[model samples]
Target chain A: MSLTIAIPKGRLGTQAIEMLKSAGVGESIDEKSRKLVFKDENRNLNFILLKNSDVITYVENGIADMGISGKDMIMENSADIYERYKMNIGRCKMSVAGIKGKRVFNDDTIIKVATKFPETAKKYFNGKGQKIKIIKLNGSIELAPILGLSDVIVDIVETGNTLKANGLEVFEDMYNISAMIISNKISYKFKRKEIKEIIELIRKEDTE
Target chain B: MNFLNIEDEMKYFQKMFLLRKEIENYLYEEGYLNIEPSIFEGYDEFTGINSRINRKSTVKLLDNNSEILILAPDITTGIVNKFLPRWEYGKKLKIFYYGKTYKHNGIGIKENREMGVEIIGEKNQNTDQYILSTAKQIISRYSNDFLLEIGNSKFLKGIMQSCSFNKEEYDNVMNLLYSKNRQDLKDYLSNLPFKNAMSTLLNILDLEGTFDEIKEQVEGLYLNELMQQGVEELSKIDNYMKNITDKVTYDLSMVSELSYYDGIIFRGYIKGSNKEIIKGGRYDSFTEQYGYKIPAIGFTVELDELIKVLDKEEQR
Candidate 1:
């Protein structure tokens, strides 16, 4: 039996494949190939490259037994999956960014926010008893506050350079995010031994 | 188009119905009768009686009398409402039902076909053993890849007796455990003033393995009076189950969403699917709602999900 693991396409996917190689469960792929699905060099594991959001969907539905996804994405989507291991490959923070100094508090005024992650933003504000209006945008979230379309933006901040160049500073860092190896609830049990072994390999690779 | 779309379209449903009949037949052979539950229930009565069911999920409608009614969201509640109140002493009720339960899934109303077996009015450990054995046997009969995951609700309830939480906080902790969100659970436990209690709860959260193996693992953790009693209660259930099936796996963190479950709780799963094929447990607390102290345990086989696997097996 083989385990099918989903990795989001792009940087995280490349990094996850590298980690899998180090764990002796995978090898480097032909980056130029048009294929989205392929078998690992070990031939005992299958890898499926998917969209950032689709990774969790695949894993949650058991199309892919396991997948590597970001904690932020996991929370936003909130699919029922087991977060097996934390891979420190894509370290970042889900933060509230706006024009530098004015900190938005839970006052009477309704704060307008823009982001790709509206559910997460709503949850964050609701936790603080802050009532806010959401203006969801697909990309270029910084433009919302810059154009005065919104008071602030909620987004993932990797190194603060993008926010700096766009003349926005993080208002509050809400959550720490990194790539996590997550497994379907049923898959975690059916393939317990194999999943445990792979997690062990990841754990050992993390320490080294 | 096959036969210009005139061919019988019930092919798929025919297969599913056959699968349902096989399950119903197995239970009937084991001395359970088919119970066709009513489709409608009094709305306020259903909601007030079954405290755990989300009120928003019940599809409410106006009757000829203009009183609000709800589509039956569960079979067990209806069964108890009928039998438990008028039971004869020393007589055990062996019942099973294949029915549709209606519920709103946030988007729209959905109906599920499930087969259930119930044994009520018995107050012995033997009843629990029979139910667990029957559940295990049924799952094994369907799929060789099935796993019967078991846990005791009193185990968590006992551990929680020491922690005083308001209604909101209690519900939050339950949600965290239900999702198995270990990261947040750790954060929630970090609020504890006592280190010993925190560590023990975390150890319990991570408890996995055989019943015996888990018992040994939790031996070193701090166990107060209630926690000890919880362990002793589950010990008997484990004793009843271990010899009958080797497919059992113990998980202490498994919390059933239904508040009625007050004893042994379990979910059955097979490979190649995340959806549970079987969900049954002891809902004795629910039985107490009828002003009687009847002991009850039962489970439902979700025929739809089982049919999915069956379809795959046939294809292969």
Candidate 2:
């Protein structure tokens, strides 16, 4: 019996494939091909390339037994999945950044924020007992504060270079994030041994 | 109301009503009593161990005395409270319930219709077997392919107690397991305050298979007395299930909500659905707190999810 694993197609895709190869997947996935699904019969595994955000949807519904995606996406989407491994790739931080700081928030004045992660931002602010309005943006979040559309933007920051280039600075750090391997709740039970073996192999390759 | 279409919505409600009738027939044939508790309840009445509702999740009204009256968040708690004191010793009560439970979700206050039966005043393998078989029978009516996953709350509690973890570490570990974060679980386990408690129990979390395979794996581990009892109970339940069906499986990381579901915990899933269509367990955790001291085992079929499964199959 072969187990299906979902890997996202983006910055972490190549690194994820490399990690899988090192973990003994036994077949090279043709990334350039027009196929979204690949089968490695020798290793008893099937791989599917999906959008970074859709990885959770596929895995959560059991279409794929396991998935590889960033912790930020997982937390933001609030996807119900088991984070199996950290993968140690695509490392970043979910933070609140703005143009060189203005004390972020000391008093509640209905601060308007912009980001792709509205739920996460709401949760963070709610935890601090501060109320804010979230103006969700798909991309170019840093420009939200610069163009006077919002007070600050909550997003993932890898290096200070992008924030500095856009004249913004990290104000508050929410949580550390990296690519994590996730599994469906039912799949974890039915495919325990097979999933564990692959996780073990990937664990070994991750440390190496 | 913002679902796909009116026809699909009507069909879903129609199927649920049909299923409810089926449930009523089965309960009546099995000599079960049907009861309906009040939809209006005091919020304090539902607070305790095994209480899945809290102040936050209740839609409440302020009375003239400034006391809050909550819309019923659960049906089982009310039924047990109303019947437990009047029950005669040595006699079992099989009761059935069909009602709408009101509770708050992240977005809004929602109501869900629950059709279920509770077997009270008995705490034995026979009762467990009866509940299991009945649950399987009802769920199989909606979906041809379904799986039953069983776990023991006492087993998990026993293992955690033996580990001697502080309350913070214990909550963190359970949350990780609840979220199925294996890597974080490993990271958290690696730095445990007690080294001896780490190795064996950590391995058990990943142990899942047929009851026989899992029994062999668990038997070889070093278990405390409480843990041993839990394992024995599960094995007995496993043996009882042999004559029924082969869809039974075991999982160690299956911890129930804190203060609820003391003994065996199980959930039923259809092959295609993301959520479990049926959830059943042995939870007498509230009886003692209510001063009744009666044991109870029951299951609820989430009609919405079941209808969704049937809808998907019909569309396909």
Highest-DockQ candidate:
2
TM-score of chain A of each: 0.94, 0.96
**Per-model root-mean-square deviation over C-alphas:** 3.1, 3.8
**B276-296 in candidate 1: lDDT tens per residue?**
989888877786766767788
Q: What is candidate 1's lDDT per residue for A49-105, written digit by digit as tens?
A: 898889999999999988889888898987778877777688899999899876665
The CA-based lDDT of model 2 is what? 0.80
Candidate 1 chain A weakest ten by summed lDDT: A23-32
Regions of candidate 1 where Cα sits further than 4 Å from its true position: A28-32, A41-43, A102-105, B1-8, B41-58, B62-69, B84-91
**What DockQ, on C-alphas, does every prediction get?**
0.49, 0.54
Model 1 DockQ, alpha carbons vs. true complex = 0.49
lDDT score of residue B221 within candidate 2: 76
TM-score of each: 0.90, 0.84
Enumerate residue pairs that collide in model 1. Answer: B280-B299
